[model samples]
Target: MKAVRIHQYGSIDNAALEEIPAPKLGLDEVLVQVEAASINPLDTKLISGDMKDYFPLTMPYTVGTDLSGTVVEAGLLAARWKQGDRVIARLEPGSSLNKHRGGAFAEFVVVPAQLLTTAPTKLDLATSAGLPTAAGTAWQALFETAHLKPGQTVLVHAGAGGVGSFAVQLAKYIGAHVISTASAANADLVHSLGADQVIDYRTEDFSVALRDVDVVLDTVGGETLSKSYQVLKPGGFLISIVMPPDQEQAEAHDITATFFGHRSHAARLDLISGLCDAGKLRVIVDRTFHLSDMQDGLAHSASRRARGKILLRPAV
Candidate 1:
């Protein structure tokens, strides 16, 4: 099998595509013929050794986490899935418990059956590959953590990026008033994704233009995160995917704050799959790259300018 791997963590240039034996299946795992995979910012961080404290990589690590493909074989104990099943799977990052696994950016991969979910019937296998990480994160932030309600207002920072694009659509689906921040060039794209108002972050200060928001989903951390509290109403929620919120600031503002680390849940993926079939959600693909061109794709993701997910087709 052909796969992309990083022998040492330093740069995307360190990643290489090479021939390797197909992964051996375990008691509760399935062998998947990789059709499509997607890249996330976490992929870049893991490559650069920046996530060492959280997701320290095993040297000679394969480079992807999100995938959609067909099952070729299943383990004896994995009876829930069978040969030829079309599915989407996400390998949970920092899963200290599972040291032996295969990366999605390969001709084939071995995945724990429990992590697999039925792909959305409305989408092709390639596009569905973009859903697992980005959509799952947005779903967790808006519904699970913040509990955003109808008629309430929520601010989504970097609304044009991977997670933010999903956040805008999901918030609108929940009937909440959605406001999002993007550069002027992406304002129209964000609005089309269902944001009620799109603020040009480069030209306008969101803290000054908005007030009394019920929830703020902060994808951009640091100063943008610190200023987010000013827009929320007392007792509102501030959810950060980047880092933990400052406890003192939360206390002084009388609001709840939390840092969300997305966990791959089968149930959450099921709901997102349904939403896609119902047309209540959409998967935005910024670009697709062949496995041989993964370095360029990783560079694009690391650029922080993609409007949505970047995809890789191993079979391409």
Candidate 2:
């Protein structure tokens, strides 16, 4: 199998595509023939070895986390899936997150049944590959974490970002008023994703433009998430995806604050599949790179200015 591996953790230049033996499925895992995969910030974090605190990888590590693929083989325990089924999964622990596992950057990957879900057939497999991490994170934050309600107001940081694009659509689907921050170039992009208001973060200060937001989904941490606490209603909540919110400050403002580390729940992925099929959810792909061009893809993701999800086509 041809796969991208981290010959070293220092930089993207250290990643290489090499031939390695194909992965064998465990009793409860499915072997997927990789069609496409997507790049996420976590991939970069793993490449730089920054997530070593929670997820320590061995010296050699394959680097993909989310992928859209076909079921080439299924374990006996994975009775629900069959060969030839198209799927998308957050290969939880199947990447650098766990030292023992390889990843979807390869020609094939074996992932646990728990993390597998049917891909949205409405979109191409390459685009569907972008959903697991970014879209799932947004879904977890907006509904499971924040519980955004209809007619309420939400301020999403980096609205044109990977998670932000999904957040805006999910918030609007919940019937909440959506306000998102992005560069002026992406205002229309966020609006098309269902955001009711778009604030040019580069040119406008969001805290100065809005007030009493019912929920704020903060994707960017530090100053942006800190300032977000001020614009929420007394009892509103702030859900930060990147880091933990300041509880003391949240209390002072009479609001709730929490952090999110997204999980790949079977139910959540099922729900996302339905939304995408019904056209209520859309996967946003800013760019795509071939499996051989993974280094370039990683560089683009690390650039911190991607308009939406960055993708990798395994078949290319």
Candidate 3:
């Protein structure tokens, strides 16, 4: 299979393409001919060795954690899936829980059957590839962790990026008035995605513009995450994805705080798929690249300013 691999982890410039051996099928694994995969910050961290403590990779490591593909073969233990079934999965990075090649940037990936979920009919398999990590992160943060309720108002940062786009739409679906921060260029785009109001972070101070939000979804950490508490209602929640929330600030503001790390669950993906099929959920794709163009796609994700999901098709 033609896949991108890091012979030595460093930067995107150091990655190279090679024909690697086909992955061995485990008893609970399914062989997927990956149609596409999307780059996330996690991929960048892994490649640069920033996450070595949690994801210790061997010298020659393949680096990708999301796959959208068709099942070319299934293990006997995977009775629910069969050859030619289209699916998507959120992989456990460098973890033993799944045998999926870090090679989602290649023509094939072997994911655990438990991680596989049927692809949404609303999106082609290629686009469906970007849904797992970004969408699931938004879902876990908003509904599972924050429990944002109807009639409440929520603030979502970087509304034009992967997770923020999903969070903007989901908050609207839940009947919450959604406000998002973005550049002036993305104002209309974020509004179209269901943001009740879009604040251009470059032009205005979001904290000065809004007060007493019911929930704040912080995709930008550091100072942005710190300032979020000032706008939340007392006892409101701050769900941070980029970094840990400031406990001292949260205490002073009388707001609850939690950092969300997305978990891969087929059941959760199914729910997202259902919403997409019903026309209630949508995937915003900023750009698409072939696996051969992996470097550019990854660099774009690292910018943290992409308009939407950046997809990489493997079988190019």
lDDT of 1 by residue, 1-316 (tens): 9999989889899999999998999888889998899999999888898987878778789989999999999999988898989899888876743454339889898888788899999998899999999999999999999999999999999999999999999999889999999999999999999999999998999999998999999999999999998899899999999999998999999999999788888789999999999989888889999999999999999999998999999766
Q: What residue pairs clash in candidate 1, if any at all? A: none
Between the candidate structures 1 and 2, which one is better when assessed by lDDT?
1
Of 2 and 3, the candidate ranking higher by TM-score: 3
Q: Over the stretch 86-191, how does candidate 2's per-residue lDDT look in tens digits?
A: 9998876534432344387888888888788998888877788888888889989988888888999999899888999899999999899999999999999999
- Candidate 1 residues lying further than 4 Å off, grouped into runs, are none
Decoy 2 TM-score against native = 0.96
Scanning candidate 1 in windows of ten residues, the lowest lDDT window is 93-102
lDDT agreement with native, every candidate: 0.91, 0.86, 0.88
Q: Global lDDT for candidate 2?
A: 0.86
Query: How many clashes in each candidate?
Result: 0, 0, 0
Q: What is the overall TM-score of model 1 with all chains considered together?
A: 0.97
Q: After superposing candidate 2 on the true structure, give the runs of residues whose Cα lies further than 4 Å from its correct spot.
A: 94-102
